[model samples]
Target: MSTVEVLASVDIVALRMAPEAQHLQVLLHRREREPHAGQWALPGVIVNGRTPDTSLEAAAERALREKTQVVPCYMEQVGTEGNAFRDPRGWSLSTYYLALLEPGQVVEGEQLAFFDLDSVLARKVLLPFDHNLLVELARERLAAKTVYSSLPLYLLAEKFTVLDALGAVQACLGQAVNNTSLRKRLERLRERGWVRDTGEKNQPRLGRPQQLYQHTPQGGRAFMFERSLLPEGV
Candidate 1:
């Protein structure tokens, strides 16, 4: 007669761009209670049936809102992990999500911080309770999505130039995308109304002005295509 595990939680890999789009960052928070209290961890919240989360997403949203006080521009459930040893108190399960914020999205809550994803992934920073593993898994999924979906677009600000979009994708994938292929994809996205050319260009101090673009009314969510900025699966 094993005891039924009561600990079920949702962890969010709330990702965003650093100022100037220098790096991709993930949101973390310091725990307040025992069992890894005071340790920086991915934003998480225990499932409380009384709060009556209408769905798993609702619970994930609550964790992001309550723990970090910021709503991501895009969010998706990545996967789940469960085991007896992950949590010290008892057997527990965690449903983790990948949430993306626009560039320069500010954190408005106390004790919430954003760390460079590279640092976390490289073990320069450590997290508690399988959180480090969760981040690694989420990044893998995010990178795959970046290859074939508009997932990286959520990392941009409301208005961005082609170069800006490339920077975002590069940050997520840790590789440079072809400027030509990216332009082609944007054209396709524009045709589908997922993106709109703002009919404006940003003047740079050094070079030519770059055209600006933004999401259209129907483009609040990430959209997928048969390919990315290249030929199918290139």
Candidate 2:
């Protein structure tokens, strides 16, 4: 009898978002073949060599280029899955990465589209492997990060309105934000000059004119935080 040795492999999973007023839309691709054929899955690729640089992060960049022809604005490893039986072909370990990109920044290939996170949650879409769990974990992390960190900036345009900025944050939290509290948060940001009013007002339908704003050049650095794992076994 011949014994076949199963080798460990690394893969990358990326979650890209499209900012919307009520929810942060996530990008998902329909797999064309097993192990999750015809199911929704995150964009990913396998690492070819055993090196630290040829890691999950590198795989994610390659996947993005192949799938959408664009590099992610920001990406970080979120966690890893090393279940022995996770892949039907062999033993595989996947390192998941979370990426944030602006809407329409990438030209998606076939079988890819932006999906509303709320709709996915409501419909309970069955995802490939443990991806459904991964999405949930990513959502929780994004919500917490948006509260005090600069993660939300990735979703906004280079210049945006205060309402638009707040809307993006609310979408991440998936809840209504108190007007007073939101104002206070903006005030703190303003005092530091991390954000400033652009002195332009947008006249949208059925509302008084609202002023526009933009994050300062230093806002990106100010809002960034060291990426950390979700939790052990999460």
For residue 217, give model 2's deviation from the true position in Å: 5.6
Q: Candidate 1, TM-score vs. the true structure?
A: 0.93
Model 1 alpha-carbon drift over 4 Å, by segment? 217-219, 228-234
**lDDT, candidates in the order shown:** 0.86, 0.63
* Per-residue lDDT over 52-141 for candidate 1, one digit per residue giving the tens place of the 0 to 100 score: 688889999999878988988888899999998888888888999999987778876568888999999998998999999999999999
* Candidate 2 residue pairs in clash (backbone atoms < 3 Å): none
- In Å, residue 9's CA in model 1 sits off its true spot by 0.2
Report RMSD for candidate 1.
2.1
Model number with the top TM-score: 1
**lDDT of each residue in 1-234, candidate 2, tens digit only:** 113544343333333446444456667777877777877777666564553445555667777766656566566667776665666676666667667767545554577866677666555666666666666767777777776675665667766766766676777777666666556666666777777878888888888988777766362343643432122332
Compared to the true structure, candidate 2 yields what TM-score? Answer: 0.79
Worst 10 residues of 2 by lDDT: 225-234
Q: TM-score for all predictions? A: 0.93, 0.79
